[model samples]
Target: MPLLRSNTADKFIVDRRKPHRNSDVARAVRRSRDRLSQRHGTPVFDRELLKLHAHAIVGSAATIPLLVLIITAAGLLGGMAGDIVVWAFLTMTCYAGLTWVAHRVRKADASRLNTISTKRNLLAGHFISGLGWVYFATLGCVNCQVEQFPIIKAIVLLLAMAATALITSSLRGALLATFALPVAAYAYIGINSWAPIELVMTGLLALSLPFFSYVASHFNRSSVMLLSFRSEKDALIAELETAKSMSDEARRRAEEANMAKSRFLASMSHELRTPLNAILGFSEVMSNEVLGPMQNPTYRDYARDVHDSGQHLLDLINEILDLSRIEAGRYQLNEEPVRLLHIVEECCHLMELKAHNKDLRIIQEFEPELPRLFADERALRQVTLNLLSNAVKFTSTGGEIRVRVGWTAGGGQYVSIKDNGPGIPPDEIPVVLSAFGQGSIAIKSAEQGTGLGLPIVQGLIHMHGGEFELHSKLREGTEAIAIFPASRVMEVLPALPTRKVAAGGRRR
Candidate 1:
């Protein structure tokens, strides 16, 4: 019977061991699934993860001296200084090793940093460093005989543990592992103590765990959100840069096309002008009967019409070529000293016949003794003629066209042409100033034009260091003014004295 009982006891022990082993296996399976889920679901960028590890290691290195001080102040180190020093040395060694790992990770290729093994190593380093704090909790101040030493030591440890959790909060798994072991040991020590104060300290430490966990969770959420925002910002910047590059390429192509058009027009000018000159010359000869008498009176009338039409076409072509040259920066000016009064008078005389045909009067308002202007003579004449022609073309029968030349407010000179015609609408001013753009008023008027006048005027004035302005009101009148800068006005110098010779041919 005794033999039978020994066998039964052995069987019973084997049965009990089976469940324990099975439970261990099950717990490990659950842990593996949790780690896998964490890895797949909440993926952090490799750089941020590495940064978290480096921060934790550096923080641990900095806390070692504080821990030693706490132990020494508790008087726990009086007899255990050698052991404490050894523990401190070991903790620092671990920190230095982890720091070196962090440095290597930081310097490694980006592809290497994202590997699973690299991340695991970082997690392992953090977990081992946590073990050092657990060692401190177990051996550093656990043997203190003084009544208040345990409380002081526990409080310091709890604070340090909370700080560690916060520092490594960007890595959730590492943070949980880091504080769990030390806090558990501290709680166990507090719970089994005989003193009420120690028990209360233990309760407080237990209650504070959830609070620290919440802090870690909060920090983790914030960090994840910030990383997401940063990633999106970088992506947006890349897209904008791509769009800008494409737009620049398109703009370059457009500029090339425009330059090609200008070159084509410039090349065709000679081909177009030669035929127009022939038409004008032959029509003039036929109209005036310079070669022979026309057999029919109707032939003379037809020849005259042909001459006028050819002249108009020639003017249009000239305006177009002049505008193209100006735009191409090839219209060089023969600049000289010119009197504004004389130019204005000449332009008026040229336009007077057209104005009289429409029964309009030309009015002149000249400032007395105005200074001569330094400018392009031909360009100034064109500017004046264009303005007067427009005034005559737009003015109604029995209307008045006023031309003024005067000193401007800032010691500069100005020439203004005003007309009582259908004035330009304010909104159409820019349209009229652009090349080949006509205002509604000009379009509706009986007389029509090529509409290159104002743009040409503006370009010529700009080249001469001057400003051009147009002011008009609806159905009231319009005024076009060209203002020359003070620099372009020739100041009169005092005349040199002429020395009189005493009836002898000698220099004075």
Candidate 2:
């Protein structure tokens, strides 16, 4: 009455475990990731690092000139505006050269770059800039009006060191190369002056240089890591693309093969059936003694066997054609309003002779006064007969086969045919339900079957927007239920009200 669940097979269960087919692709991706991770200093990433260094220098091009202007303005307050201007001019000239080199490098292609040579040139430029700072270390006026000029100069040098570390972080060893000379110059000038403030500043600058260099190195490593992650992401996307292409290729081949099979079967239907019908006709005449009595009884018996074998072959051919039509989406449904109970009952009657032969008893139960079901009448008949035949064929002698027709809780209609046959194993339910598939019991039985009964039934039910469920348990029994939705169960319409016209040809 509730949603009649198929307990025999866990058809709705999705298995998360699947055989992995992309091991080679996965291994290649891993290998690529590992190689990218370790190849930071190699030619590929070296080119990337160079490009980043160039961009960093060019992007913040205004900062250096601005710092120089501020320093010149501060020095002008020393009253030696002439010396201050000269220093600014020379320093500005050095920075202008550095900026030009960075801009050129940024525009240069990978082919033009020699990583080692380019790095050396950049390092030399930084060292030249360091010479400018060396001059700054000794440029302060001792007797100037400002008392903290030395401290200001020391702070300025430290600031410059910090900025250079940030700017050249992408290019390895550039920070140390730039500030190495300046720190030495500052320390020498400080120790000679014998000023505690200068000496203390000098020691601070000495320690700060290495610290800033380490910071730059750390930043460079971070850049390498970012590149690694980016490369891995690109690799994954590429692998996905390759997989998609391969899948498309396989699908195209499969579709082509399916089309070829359809064409072959279409030709074979006429080819095979023409000869088979001849075989059946000749065998039937001989078996029935239609022309005359056979001379030998053995000859008559052989003719009967031939006729039976031909009939079986014909059944198998018909089943194959029906399944193909269903699978190829060519099986169109001719839906009509029909009695569900009557059709199932009739199918039971049709199969009664076969059940009687097997000494099996079929019990039929129908819900009375059920509504007409909208379905393909022929398909419904075939579905019921297939199920019934399977029951009669497999059911043991004196076994009871129960058939029920009733309304579902959802107001839908269902027909269930259950038999106390040597039941299907739980694992074999799927096999039995597949086209040309048989269970171990069916295999061992003396009964001959093409094994397409349940599958054809399932296809027919599906065509009518219904569910076909096969329930079975080892040694207990098997039940095959075909359920049609409420939509297919046509409701009885209300009778129309009639009124007579009063002396006119019009109805009120």
Candidate 3:
């Protein structure tokens, strides 16, 4: 009953089978497990060990019964011990011979039991061997005839039979039969033949069945579980290696793309500037009456438009190249001593006409004791020009623009440009500083701009190791600030040309 209720019994029992494949299910399971181990790159089990186990199952089943017969015969032949000695030795020899054969069978093709084909063979061999054991038990019972022997001896002979069937082959069936028949026969022997020790031994053997079944079930389950876990771990490690490789590839591609973009910008800047210089130069000559004056005022107007549009295009191209160099981290600085106040004055003077045309007032506030700062003159000029131009562009007619230049001790000098024009919207101020990003005002006004000016100003200032700041509110006005480190500011001045205006819009 314990064996019937056991986990292995529950799984391997006839009722648990589907009836159609029940006869061959164990064989199929063994074959499938073996094949799975082979295909999955798992280490294969030793075939020799499996075959040895199989032979041991069959050989032990057969030998157990014969041993019982020999012992019973020995007891019965006691009276004619001397005369039957040779026969007994002959019987013992046959038993040893069969055992030796079983050992040889086990040794043959030991690796074969782990294969799918061999596992089926092993299972079939077990069943057939069990049937052979039943036959052997029948022989012993027939030879020890019931009519000649005492009933007790005959019964003891029958009871000892259960041991001949090795429990390892079909564990479930072996366990049940081992307990049932042995206990019944032993009980009969004890009551009828006064062998209580034999009854106790039989009882003890029956009790051992559940413990062995429990241990065997867990062992099989543990083997399968460990294999499953190891397989999953290996697959996960492989996937991680693949992902790391892809990530490294993506980083390499990003760097290459950035390099290509910088090369394109440098090439485009040169190409565009070449033609633009020729157009502006020709326009300047024409405007100066070098061709004896344009015969028609319309011709002059056309020439002026050409000059202005060409310059505008050139400015856009230059800004794009500047931003490209900054993003690529290839922009270099030329350090020179610069009069901070003078540079601020030059920017105000340049934007004077544009401010007047818009009717906006200009105001300059310079701290008289400002120190000469070390900086890149061309970059500072561009930064100052951008701030002034943006302020003028957004200012309404009759607004005020204020320019301030001063020093912040221990750190740097600051240039502040403030305008009371239609100010930047709070949400869009940061966006306007980004490349190709414009504010709501510029979009609504249909402003003709490439949107690269502010970004270039920020880049130029940062290259000088300075801070560029902005403060604005919608419709109020914007304040643009630049701060440069004092240590980078030059301590000595070199003889430089005085700031000169382009006389009548012509560079001198």
Better of 1 and 3 by lDDT: 1
User: Model 1 segments beyond 4 Å from truth?
Assistant: 1-80, 108-119, 140-147, 498-508
Off by over 4 Å in 3: 1-251, 407-410, 489-508
- Tens digits of per-residue lDDT for model 3 on 1-508? 3544444432212232222223244444454455445422232532433443445555565565466456546645544343234434544454454445445556666433344554445444444433432322222223443443333433443443334333333222333333344344444544564555545544554455455455544443454455456545655554455555556656655665667677777766778899999999899777776869678888788888889889988877877888899888888888777787898898899999999999988899898967677888888898999899888888888999999988766657899999988888889978899999988788887455778888888888888888899999777889999988777765554555455343534663
Global CA lDDT of candidate 3, please? 0.63
Worst 10 residues of 2 by lDDT: 11-20
Q: Candidate 2, residues 372-447: lDDT per residue as tens digits?
A: 9888899999999998888888888999999999999888999999998788888988898888899888888888
- How much is the lDDT of residue 413 in candidate 3? 88
Clash totals for all models, in order?
0, 0, 9
Residue pairs in steric clash, candidate 3?
47-110, 47-111, 48-110, 48-111, 65-164, 373-489, 373-490, 374-489, 374-490
Error of 3 at 63 (Å): 36
Per-candidate Cα RMSD to the true structure, in Å, reads 20.9, 10.0, 20.0
- Tens-place lDDT per residue, model 1, 12-46, is 12222222123444444554343333431343465
Clashes of 1: 0
Q: How close is candidate 2 to the true structure, as a TM-score?
A: 0.81
